[model samples]
Target: MTRRAAIEGKPVGSDAYVALEARYGHFTAMQVRDRRTRGLDLHLERLESANLELFGVALDRAAVLGSIRAVLGDDVRDASVRVYVVESGGRPLVMATAAPPFHLSGRPQSVKPVVYQRYLPHIKQAAGFPQAHLIRQVARDGFDEALLTTEDGVISEGAITNLGGFAGGRLIWPDAPMLRGITMGLLQRMDVPQERRPLKVAALPELDQVFLCNSRGVVPVSRVGDVELRQDGELMARVIGFYDAIAGDPLD
Candidate 1:
């Protein structure tokens, strides 16, 4: 059993490669600014829940936080961080990795709808090959990301994000199963008029605007499989503003 947080080199999880190479674990990603991040509790809860579900053991909150703090160390305050909780020999180990930070790009994205869903859709698996593959495949279609949907064209989510739409001056979240992204959770807590319902692909044109949100950031959707959607600049701005208004929790 690996008790302490695995440490390797500066702010990067050199030891993490082995765990990921096995492709058998779950993880959470977050953008850290000045060693702080929004929804730290949500992230931790995700890890704890996945750990219990996958490894049948309670997650060590201290160990997980220790690894993340260790990887960030004193050198990395602003970066992209991923904490991986993997089991080996019936014991779970905590690993943390850091990379360059990225924020929301107001640039609208065009996505292609793909009729696919992830296995164990609830847990955020550490390694996602289908998402990577679909992303590459859709890039050939001149699309930014692959929108995962049901065969019936029921909108589910992005290959790597949560889907949101604005229609009739209200925020609508897909009622389908998804990872319940940290950003989405934070935004849901805000004072936005929103609803969760089963959204369909054909409904895209009827909506005023659509968007994709993840731990990195949220961006307006310009097109959904050739269906051009209007961009409600005011709505998107307000959503982003509400997200940013939430103070980040200090990592220390």
Candidate 2:
């Protein structure tokens, strides 16, 4: 699959990849279809908030959008895009990358809980070494994704997505600190019966269903640790229905 990379809105050469290592920084991921995206405003707001919190300056929304368009170019209209505020030697730089479109597999996920929490959980940190490490460790142990939790087993979120549960025909998101994902935000805006509160690994058995959400989309979880989740197909189908009904916002 073809991929493109750029820094400060200009294409990066093969040799430039090495230099970008030091420029790695915070970012927000999104999927674009026909130059349109779901929750584009929320994605931009995430970048803006992260930029301010990490660099003490507001994100250049126009410049970032232009960079995304520039990197995507005319030929590439549908793809997975990531907008990064690269912290180089001097001032931060805007980097954008376009890759093959991605989507969550409808298959239920199996997650393994780990006693770990990301630093500054609100922002999507560029370096998620701990999360990545735990994911790898759990994968070796036969889990699909790592579920982040406190030392005492308080469920916070998934390594790369927001975690939630459904029971009694209502949804509930963990109250613990985690990135406010764009996809999750969009669902919250719609007419849905949901609430947030501290969730624990032990509570998984109580909920009729579990799910994870990110830019790629939402999917149900089949298992967390040794506990197999109940198959709440109707609830999940309704969620996907609501999500699919959300029209993409035009990038232009």
Best by lDDT: 2
lDDT of each: 0.83, 0.84
Tens digits of per-residue lDDT, candidate 1, 1-252, equal 122224322234355455453467899989889899999999999988998899888888887788778877766788788888766666776777777788666799998999998888889997788899999999998999999999999988899999898888788999998789999898888676889999998898788889899998888998999889888898888888888888889999
The TM-score values for the models, in the order shown, are 0.93, 0.94
Q: What is the lDDT of candidate 1?
A: 0.83
- TM-score of model number 1: 0.93
**Per-candidate alpha-carbon RMSD to the true structure:** 3.6, 1.6
Cα error of candidate 2 at position 78, Å: 1.5
